[model samples]
Target: MLPPVKKDRVITQLPQCFSPNAALHTKDGFHPQVKAMCQFQRTATVSFNIAKVIVVGDVAVGKTCLISRFCRGAFDKNYKATIGVDFEMEHFEVLGVPFSLQLWDTAGQERFKCIASTYYRGAQAIIVVFDLSSVNSLAHARQWLEDAMKENDPSSVLLFLVGTKKDLSSPDQLSQIEQEAIRLSEEIKAEYWAVSAKSGDGVREFFFRVASLTFEANVLSELERSGSRHVGDIIRITDNTDGHRRRKRTPQCC
Candidate 1:
């Protein structure tokens, strides 16, 4: 059963409200099977940059749907309450390097707030979504950002304000939505986008920008801790199947 939603979320920032609640005991959709594989196996040429990212927004603004579309390339119209937070792992190769992202999708309902913020703490990037059809949700976008920022390291959290349900946006609804997003983004200093999660619009580029920002963020974070400007590269060599040792290249930022 889901935990009862707390009314004393006195902190306007829901993400901050989540600070007191540790992660739920249940790892509903989290699977780290590959971690063991790497630990047990000797893979000398393995390459990847793994990062944790969390997606957040107000209830019914399509947080779940957007995640479905982005990760699975599909959507579900049926209504099913997210018991807690859900997760997906996506691996992609970009710019001759391999990257993996742990994508977290949190329940947006007011009642599930307790379980939501726990996942925000270590996120390298965040996507804050709002519904184009609802002004109230758009207004709440800042609160989402605040909550996420509270749990995460502010210096490196690459946040983007996405106006979802753009397929429903008409010419009449377009200007006001754009202005509100732009104004709020400036106020909070966030990047804003109009996207149709149903049509997969702006989804790829959204994360592409995030990946680029996070890659840089990782480098800066390493340098700051080590007091060194240069992040190194990882070059591993191993004996091949039928031949001599082979070399593998991976970016070792910081």
Candidate 2:
């Protein structure tokens, strides 16, 4: 059975680092031009209620541990690398509506790259995890993101740069690594988060933020696809006295 949805969850807005206009071109690919438009009004009913979230990064970066911590509330001390790809379904209640998120964990080894990359398509959110104590892991984030973005529509996918094993890094070391992580996050336009799976620090917050932001984005995209049609635009009424007249007009927004 899946975990129950938390009703007290409150996600007011997207983080400051999130930008809907961020450049989403993959490496060695043509950058598509996109035009910005004013925010359209959303209907009461959401067209999409499911979101797919993919986690990608280098080996031994704790991608599995992070997901386990969020989903099962437990972490494994044994280090077993992911083989190809694994997934888990998480339920959420966003803005008083029930929603579902599919979390995909891809293998970070080169041997499984081909198999894992095949599952990257149609992802609603991509999380790139790195080891805070390993600088090399941080450097490879760009390549991982490129591989995943190549199979997805970059404009529609939300990106996040996560640093795992926060408990292993010293305060001084963490500060230095954070600077570099911030620079890379800005370059890729992905949100930055630091968490310790073993200690369970910042794990819940990170997942909640991801779920909320993706939910909001999904709602907005559905509204745009619906072409400005508001909910309850059509209505019917009858007059008993006249019995032959009909009237209709677009409902006014209050």
Candidate 3:
């Protein structure tokens, strides 16, 4: 596991999820309530040591593109493929809790198959992305789901079905194809979402939904740790070490 924080603070407990929702990946699939990112208030970054994430998908499904947009807030239209796994990090505060996401975007081609397993280890969340235009990539979600489940810490690991490049697909086609993909996500007890990295559609939502889920998981983990061990001077709000380095802003409490 990476260092809990780039620098561990003397403070004890951190704040909990500011979002009111209790769970993610419901029977309805995509969340209708999360209209925009749950942004934080302006404060000095106080890094909290927290969760990790992994992004998985078939080649050309916009996995790397999604990370680029989310982490760097920039996009590239070029088609250079990821050789193995592309990496990026972002620090943000949620519900007054500072957190960092070490996002690993993996290669989807068959030649890169062996590398996926190694990357999947110790992942707190797995995003399985598929192209809305390709039945083959959409169908591949099954394999991606199974491989993610192989890691098997259901409570800590989140499995999400991400449909990429919605801009290229006709509206009818996008909805029709997404319905089928969401059905599969449901079958596997996962949530489904559509995004267009090029157009900046659902890209942030896709990641924020995962962050919300991870936020809940982190709170629970912290609670468990607090109960099991005793600590003093705990500040409810905290930012991760990497978060401190990534962003200077602090999150507001709900």
Best by lDDT: 2
Candidate 3, residues 1-254, lDDT tens digits: the string is 23343232211122232122222433322122211112222243343535668788788888888888776668898957776666666654445445566787777777776765666778888888899998899888888767866766876677777788888999889778977886787676666777788888877666666665666565555556666332111213443343323412112211
**Which 10 consecutive residues of model 3 have the lowest summed lDDT?**
30-39
* Model 3 global lDDT (CA atoms, 0 to 1): 0.62
lDDT of 2 at 253: 20
> What would you estimate as the lDDT of candidate 1?
0.61
Clash count per candidate: 0, 0, 12
**Model 1 residue pairs with clashes:** none
Q: Estimate each model's TM-score.
A: 0.70, 0.76, 0.73
The segments of candidate 1 whose C-alpha lies over 4 angstroms from its true place after superposition are 1-46, 227-254
Count backbone overlaps in model 2.
Answer: 0
lDDT of 2 at 93: 60
Assess candidate 3 and give its TM-score to the true structure: 0.73
Per-residue lDDT of candidate 2, residues 1-254 (tens digit): 22345554434333333222332222321111101111111233332256889999999999999999988889998958887888777766654444566788888889888778878999999999999999999999999999999999988999899999999999999989988988888788898888999999988888887886776676567556666554222111112212211222222222
